[model samples]
Target: MFRNNNLSVCWRLVRREFRFHKGRNLMAVLSVALTMALFTVLSVIIQSLVGSVRDYCIHDMHATEEMYRQFLVSQLPELFPYFLSFIPVFVCGFLIIYNIFRIGVDADIRFYGKLITLGMTPRQVRVIWYGLALAVCGLGIPAGAALGIGGAVVFEHEILNFSKIPIGMIVSLKAIAAAGVLSLLTVFVSSFRPARITAGISPALAVRYMELSGFERKKEKNKFFPISIGTGNQVGEDDRKKRITPRRMAVYHLARSKRRTAVVIASLSLAFILLSCVYVQYISADHDIYLHFITFSDYTLSVEGAGADGANISRDLEPSLIRQVEALPGVSRKGALYKQEEWLDLGEHVYSRLTNYFESEGGWRLREMESDVYWTKAYENMRKNHTCIGMVYGIDSSYTELLARPEQLIDGTFDAELFAFGAYAIAEGVEGGGGQPNYQVGEQVEIGGRTFEIMALSIAPAYLRADNDSAESAFSLGLFIPEKSFRQLYPQRGIRELHLNVEEEERARVDRWLADYQNTKDPFLDIRSREALKETFDQQIRSGAAVGALMALTFGVIGIFNLANTLIAGLLSRSQEFAACLKLGMSDRQLLYMMIWEGVCEIGLVLAVVYPLALLAAGPGMYLYLTKVSNLWAYQYRFSIWPLLICTPIMLVAAAGIPFLCYRIIKRQSDTSMDPERPGAWS
Candidate 1:
């Protein structure tokens, strides 16, 4: 019998809800559609952009195979981990939309009493209401999901060929599924039981009690802001006298005997948090990739030129006009390094060997050279050790004074004696053919078929030379060689690339001039500034973030707006309660003020709770996600105080404003012009 009653009640509740606000339900559904559509479209656009950029980064940029390896290794840890970070996002989204749904719940109760008085059983009513909520949620979720996924696919495949990537298909599918499931869950959870509880309330009590309504709450204030002729005043003077303070009054109004404002507030807070999280993540990632531009101290420029083989040369630079053009630039020292295309048969097999030029004592060598401006002691040691193979570099012996501590030498080497020989010297990372103790300062090593004694053994950058497994890695390794000796090893290979450190302010200007130089002389050369390259990278990251946020925003807005509509509906239902307050002298201003205050309080409380919760959930989740999925060492956590400070006030205003507007509309519709003498006409 209980089961049958519950089932009957559930159906009745659904029918009543549908009957009460047909248009509202339709509008809510439409809003959901729009939100889902926008979200889907945005996701595809961003993903495509990211895909495009990723290809560029990997294939075009030539960032070294080791870098690629490290990238993959860093991400390998996340291979098996679920993309659980999205869970918090969904939860937060639900919270926001749930508040909107509560409004509907409130309205359901106001009318529930009317239905109960007619004949509905409490048990039956409860079941029916819960059922309606579930039904609506179920329908809404699939609809929203379909819209979201459909939009995304259209854009990804039709507009942007980014869907070509294997992962792109998977991502698109996941996004659609997630959006659909979350939307359904949020509505179902929010709608369930609201109407049923209202039905269970004592019908006698509901019928006898004077409920609150927008017009009834403003009777006294009507004297000042007179109610419309058709609107009826319901409250008496005594009710208004009980509440005076704006803040307290507002609290009472939202809290009322049945508080839905609290629920609404909770919803808004959740939505805000989700939006903020997505925005922050996206913005931060974009900034991270472009941080080089924001904080760059040197004017770095990448000069691209071609070589006959793997090497580059100013001589081979084309119409020969480029050299003259380059010389004409805002005068500054410019040198180039070219690794001529060479095939070396190491006996076993031929491996593509790309040997970059480093200036050494005799000439050039097949090693990497770095101008060490930090250590003089180690610089001196390298000078004594001539044959430190893999690496050769230039150094300013004077800076050795800065690295005076022995610990510096033990760790990074403070010796400057290494720099004097050949205007360059080998630091470390090579040994004799067989396998000698890893070459140290006092040891001898062979590199490029030349044997030289190590003046000093010290660690200075390029620590390890290897690759790891990962799609995203940034690692570099090579032997350090001095500048003067660079000519001896690769005297034949021309300069292919030049790394220039210019003044930060002059970087752009310098790049323009260099580009102009390259264009005039050779069509084959490509000059890229760090700024431009970084911009491309940043754009890609921004696209990915936008995609995630779009999904969140879709369900979030649908939930919130519907919640707002429902809140208003419920507020209008309590016409009798509001009538008492109105007659008691509560002015229109006071009532409106109270309503706004109620909204503010509710939203504030919810935010207070949710902010901490979101942080707790998202913080560690993001850390683990990034650490496992990317080559990044650790996920840096940051909270921008400004966003919260700025958004809080805005959200408060919006929350209050929505209810106030609804109250006015309802008040205008009520018949207030009827004289007091006609009290029993409808009563």
Candidate 2:
């Protein structure tokens, strides 16, 4: 009978709390609902895409048997790791809900104290808060599930249309069930601390617990001006007469509540950081893609034939076909190069000696060693019997000129002297370091019993055929020698590739000509156009940007929700203070202005923290992407501030709008309660 009475009393308290704090409760419910909806929608979309990819790979018209086998054996096994990405979303949702409830419970500490004084047990208090939480979840989860299903259907339709996949939405019942469970868990976990605080508070202390403090008050006397003042003695006597402003009062309140201030700033800053990082990623990717295509020739023509090498094609082109291509009406200029596989006779002792020099000499000067006549002679004598195989390119002045611009050279010049003096140039085969021969300009190296001077050191362009999987290139340690010397050494090797430039208006004609030529005269020739490559890159950019935008939006929503909750809690907590200011002759308009100032100050603080950190983090990532992914030698890191600039005004408006709206609602309720015309107005 006592337990039943306790339960009845707790239920009555819960109903009363809900009735009086309807707005706050509603906001709390919406916050949970929104988080759940976002999680469910994201999960549904991911599952749909995974299913679609699996189906498309299995039944795709273009997929080879080997590709299908590889997807099944390798890719499908790796799908479990992708679920780990959802952990952050779950954590952020928990934090949001926890923060909202903690603020609410803290504001209502006195109310709980009152209940405790009314003979309610601590257990009853726990039941009241827990029951309220469960009730909110019961309403939120189902609504979220419905919205998630609708979102999934829309997403599936778009994805299928874009990918041309003939698959229906594979809604995962298991995933939906998991989402519901996670939502309930989040609510319970978030409410646990608040419930404990409420249940544990002593009735006497709770009733008198007026404010939170970061530090205990000290008795020390200091000549410090209060934040509430508009001006101080520091600014002289005349300035001290200035009126106390609402803005000053807001700043004072913010200063007093350091913990709350920090939490609000952190929440807002984190979202801004995420947004800025996304912008950085998008810009970096777009820049890298552009750099990749620009590093190659505008148009390329090549031939392949069966050979002893793994290549089912020989490293030779037909002279007649080259002549015909060069004579085409739309052709502006042409260049050719002969690529051949060869062996480098680096003596067995050479690798060991270089390794020793790299470790012990404090620095490696092997490039200078090649130029030193004495060292070259020593190396030649020591390595006479050792040989390592690599690819070598034989090019004329025209071919060198047709490569990427001269600025792409990392250390040396691309001059006519390279071919004129029968010299070779070395390019680093790997990114960061290593790969290239330790040879510098004016150096001479003997290959196949003939010595050639080193005229340049450069970054390898994308057009040069090299191993893609490894850091070191098959040609990095090899050579780029003049065609004359190349022909003398390997007389049988002919031109295997040619690059051509065509007038802008005549690109279509040239494309048509090449297509016809490949169809009839030489089916072995492969041709690619710059226009087609650009289109492919554009498509990739659009799809990637779309996905990035969606992720940013999700994080942005969480942040905005957090800001709104913080503003409402902060404003409501200071209701008595605002009421006191009104009694002290401060107008309602001034109070509204104070709220706006507070919002703007929060946004400004967030920007100050987020921008610099985001840029600093983005720098190294952008550098690595340029060097490794794009193989760019002359790439410049660009900081995109446009995202910050564009988002600032929007954030400012949201910050100001949320507080003003909350203040208006609270003020109206206060007015209605104080009216003499209303029944039980005093009560």
Candidate 3:
């Protein structure tokens, strides 16, 4: 009977406290709801995409039903990595929610103390607080889940029209349930410490505790600076004055509660960092995609014979047709590239040496080499090692100039004249064995029975192919000789690629002319303009940017919410101090200005920590991406500062405005209780 009475009292106290602080309670609920909504929506979208990809791969890419089944079985382990990535998001959400709840509890410590004095047990107090938390989560999680489903639907609609494969909005009941459960768990865990703290508050201390000023005074430390005898007294005096301004005092308030300050800073700065990193990643990926797939030309017209793989059968462009196109009104430049697949003999000794090297390096130790088949397959195996097969391109000096620039060259120089005179240029091989290839500049190598000297080593272009037989394969081991030398070596070889430069305004007319030419002269030719190629990938770029923007906006909102809570909590904790200031002849306007300065100082400090930390975190990711893609294509890292620049002012305004608004509200509620004539008011 006594326990029941205590429970009733605790419930009444909880209800009264919540009713009095409705705004604060609502903000707490909103913060949790928004975070859950973002997590759910992103999860739904990811699952839908994975399903779409699986379906497409099975129906369109797989050659047989058996292959599709096997592929599905093999992909079971991939889900683990996806689950692992969510751990950080979950941790961040927990921290944000925990900090908010802790602040809320601390703000109302005196109220809890009053309940304790009214004969409520600490256990009953904990139950009341935890129960209130559960009620808030009950309202917030379901609403958040609904919002997530709606977001997923919108995302699906945006992508469906652009996708080649059919896609539909898929809402997984299991996923929704998991999200709600996770959110509830987060709330419960976050409330645990705060509830305990509230329960332990002493009645006597809580009733007398007006503000954090006493604690701040106890913890404050003074620093001494050394000065020369001649410059002694005045040196430290100026520094002391500078440090004692209103702005510095505001900063000191923040510094007084180190843990709260750190939490708020981390929450806001993490969101900023994530947004910046996503934008940077999108820019880098977009640049790489364009560089790899698009050739260095305003337009390309590929000629081929009728075959299943059109590239397998090369066809020549008639000289008369080329002349006619060049003479047309808009042509600025024209060049032809002849592509031929040829096998070069690297000699028996070189083949044996390479095979021995691979064996010594344990390249094939995992595979079983049957003794019976080894002797039978010796000639064929040796021929595979001795033969280097690649697409040999014939280009003129102008085309060489259109390739990678001088800085891309690892050694020697991009001497187009030398290349035109039968000297060959090798691309720095893909990363393997060592940083560079065994061969170097000025080395002589025989190609098609003719000797050629290596002119330069450049970063590999995307067009080169690697020989699978060699353990250490060079991406740019293929030949690039002058067109004159190419013709002399193989008189029957025909032009396979035609590159042209046209005026921007005349591109459409040129495209139309090319279509007419293809219809009349050679139906096997494929023509592509730079604009058309870019348009083909337009949806991909839009999707990337949209995803980044959505993530930024979602996390950004949560961060701002956290900042507001911090400012409100800080101000409420120091209400007594502000009242003391007012009684000491500090005008309301002055107090408001000081609060605004505090807000500014908080955001300024957060930015100072966030920018460098974000840069440090993003640097390695950028490096790895650049190195991997650089091997396949030429690309440079571009720093994306626009997102950061745009977000800065928004954060500053939010930081300053939140505190100022909270102060206004508190003033209107008569919480400061200023008395100018009271004794000790000036003190």
Candidate 4:
């Protein structure tokens, strides 16, 4: 008898099944390809970025093996965000691959049972399903590798070029191979559960399982309803109304495949959770942007031509415009720094302060310091003109915070209230010996006939007056006085610098207002926003925020694809169920309503699941991740909830609309409203 030897026939039959379910198979292939692509891209991020950092950024180029290991350990935190990108891709891969084979096994349970009745063994059935997955992987890996690597090249090129990073694109053949192997391995592992499910189902169990598949013909008392597959007169009419309503029937449908429905919801939730992570870690981080070069606030307005014809150019940056800018609704905080470069006659003060630094050290600190040229210059200026050069920087209360960096506060505090009360801050630590006078906190320094207590001394770089000319290495003694006091001293210098923060939503509006003013009113105003400067600074890392966006987009697309595949395949496989529902007098409108309810339930479940999961990631998980990295030193646990505002609507629309669109397509394509391949499914 052929019963024990018909293995070839079963192989051919499953091959036919794959062709028959080509849409599902195609989705399987796409998922595999995308997973492979994500993996390949991750490999590139590691090899290219890590290698570039190791080669270029490492302090110890001639490092020992142990040192190299330490370097890698140190960089892992920096690499975490790139790793986060692949998580959603992996989730989508798992759910889609697992769902594809699970649905296959359940749908073809009776077919496999028939095959077993003829000759096939459990081992053969398992091999057949595994082989089908292998076939999908075989088509997917190469395509995915090419796409992933190529995309990384394009993206990294733009990133590196904009960031001015001197790293070239690196395409590792090994990474591609590994990606392919991993994808193949994932398919192999993901195929196992469904294979086991198919192999373990005995013929009797397969016959009984048909009723649970949502397509079993109703056991009607009236055999007249032969086409009924989704509903039942097997129960009383009252029972149908009370128990077997479409709502309950949908719940039963989902309850029967609870694990599968969970997989779908979990897949959807992972995308949102990752997006929220991006929001918390990347968006918040971007908002907390620090630019060492950005002086005080969001935008600074100074006269570009003030360096040349300062008084005349300063006149162009009018008091009227300052008032207009201050009155601008978007401008949150504004302040002015009125400067007066003066040569005060500090004859005795100059002689003492200039010699103080050299006298403290046993020897000259600098080669220039050893010379009496500075001494001669200072004494001669005092003796001849009875004057020494100095700068008076006028600041409002807002600039006190900028003047006192933690490391640069050599002594005293930058208390704003104290500053407003006639206290002055002095910049100390001269580059080549002549800087702020040796003045203790509470000591008085004279400026334009006003005596003020030195409340603080800061060596802040902004106060350093750094110049490219090596000869001009020394910083002059500069004192910061309150804006009102300085205006009383130098009223002609209207405002040297104006710094202010603009509301983020109103930045563009303010920018437009400034642009118009600059074009028509003051071309030499020299407006600089922290926006452009921060963009350049972010370009230095090519923006982790940008990487976060790519992650959200990639995951969103994959999530959409998975949802589409699951909903469409799940619906298409159950044509007989819809026919049965129609025969049971469930109208098309009612069917759509039930399906819509299913989608709503899925979205609701996703929302219910994603909140805690995201919170868990944002709370302790974010804390842990943040503590491990040096680059993210400034990052705090401010989890942005804006991703919900974006993903929720997209998910709601997808969940509600996918089923409607799929059913409409199915109906419009078929005049009889039955699958062409499954006869008597409707009639």
The list of candidate 1 runs beyond 4 A from truth reads 1-16, 23-82, 100-106, 109-178, 189-249, 256-262, 271-322, 334-414, 422-443, 453-477, 501-524, 537-570, 583-590, 600-640, 672-683
lDDT of 4 by residue, 1-683 (tens): 55454567656866887789887788788888878987887777667776665554333233444545555666576668667756566666777788777777767888888767766788888878877887898888887888887778778844444333356666778778867877888788889988888788778877767524434334322333223444544766654545545565565555555666677777766667766775676544443435553455788787644232111223225788888988888796566676666556555765577556544565233323222233334444454664555667777666666666676677776777767776565545443344555455777777877777778776645522321111111234566778878888777777667778898898999999999999998787777788787666556444455555565566667677766766776777777777666655666777788887777776667678887787687667776777664446445556666777767887889988988886776566544655455533322
Candidate 3 lDDT for residue 337 = 76
Compared to the true structure, candidate 1 yields what TM-score?
A: 0.60
Candidate 3 lDDT over residue span 567-671, tens digit each: 888887677777766664555776788899998988888888887876765566665666663342333556766777888898899888888787877686554
Candidate No. with top TM-score: 3
Best of the two (1, 3) by lDDT:
3
lDDT of 2: 0.63
Superposition TM-score, candidate 2 onto the true structure: 0.63
Best by lDDT: 4
Q: What are the per-model C-alpha RMSD values against the true structure?
A: 11.7, 9.9, 8.9, 12.0
Candidate 3 ranges beyond 4 A from true positions? 1-20, 41-88, 110-134, 142-185, 199-217, 220-256, 275-294, 303-327, 339-431, 434-460, 463-494, 514-526, 532-553, 572-586, 611-649, 671-683
Best-to-worst TM-score order? 3, 2, 4, 1
lDDT, candidate 4, at 89:
63
**Steric clash pairs (candidate 4):** 229-580
User: What does candidate 2's lDDT look like per residue over 1-683, in tens digits?
Assistant: 24333597777777777777777677667767766766676566567656766566544323444544544444443444236535655666676777777887778899888878876778988999888888778788888787767765765444333233454676788768877888888889888988998889899988777555323333211213333432223654544544467776677566655555565555555556656655665565554546463534567777655333222343466888778777877685456677766556564444554444434444344433332233344444434534444457777776566442464455566667635567555543233444334555666667667777666666556665533112122112546777777788889877766778887888888888889988998886877667766665555445444434554566667677777777778887777777666655566678788998988887777777777766665666555665675543434556686777887788899989987886787687678545455432322
What would the per-residue lDDT of candidate 1 be over residues 250-325, giving only the tens digit for each residue? 5555545344444444545555565656555554464443443232222222334433332222322342443544
Q: How high is the lDDT of residue 44 in model 1?
A: 40
